[model samples]
Every structure is written in C-alpha cells, then in structure tokens.
Target: MQRRRFKETSSLEERLDQEAMRLREHKLLPPGWLREQAFRKARQMNIAAHINEWLASPGLRAPI
Candidate 1:
C-alpha cells in the first residue's frame, strides 16, 4: 500500500485559524453540534501545533 504526500502552502497555525474563522462565519456554529465538533477539532489542532513547536525548540535539542 502507498500513501500520497503533498507540500502544504500554509503553516499549521494559519490553517487552524482559517478553519475557526470559517466556522465563526457560519450561523450554525453557535447552536449546531456538528459545527461545535469542528470548532473543537480546530482548537485541538492549535494545541498540537504549539506542542510540536515547543518540542522542536532549540532549547529542547540537546547535543546527543
């Protein structure tokens, strides 16, 4: 089996922000459970991006 890979044009933070903003523009975002789930996913994505950045910091990279 093979998986397809492609280059991403935007940063993770940008993509997450765009998703949140798109949801905010929808009226259903406030009262719809489905949109709520999407919002939660966006938030989780942001948290993961931050964690990845933290782990990739120069301070964390020891001379091993």
Candidate 2:
C-alpha cells in the first residue's frame, strides 16, 4: 500500500481569506461573525461546566 502526501502551498492569510470568501458565498457567516459566535459558545460552555462543578462539589453545594 502506498500513502499520498499533500502539501499546503497557500499562505495563512490567503487560506483565511479564501475560507471567509467561501463562507460569504454560501450565505453563512464571515470570519468575524463566526469568531464571535464561537467565542460566545465557548464562554457559555465554560460557564455551564463551572456551574456543574460547583454543584457537584460538597463544599459548594450548600442550599441557599
């Protein structure tokens, strides 16, 4: 069996621009919007995880 190797010839900026253009063409989000959305999702996830951990810890589980 033979394996094929692929090379990335484009610069990082070029790749990013191409991706942003593709997103725009598809009526999806541009890079900034996508970044903001991802950040918001990550923040929400972190908050949820923290709350879960707080609830699970015996010291922090005291009733209000």
State every prediction's TM-score relative to the real structure: 0.59, 0.43
In model 1, residue pairs whose N, Cα or C atoms come closer than 3 Å (at least 3 residues apart or on different chains), thus clashing, are none
Pick the TM-score winner.
1
What is the C-alpha lDDT profile of model 2 across 1-64, one tens digit per residue?
A: 9999989898444555555444345334556776676556555555665666667779976678
Cα error, candidate 1, residue 54 (Å): 0.5
User: In model 2, how large is the Cα lDDT of residue 55?
Assistant: 71
- Give the true-structure RMSD of model 1: 2.9
Can you write out model 1's per-residue Cα lDDT over 13-61, one digit (the tens) per residue? 6786777666555555457787677777767767876787788789998
lDDT of each: 0.73, 0.59
- Global local distance difference test of model 2: 0.59
TM-score of 1: 0.59
Backbone clash tally for model 1?
Answer: 0
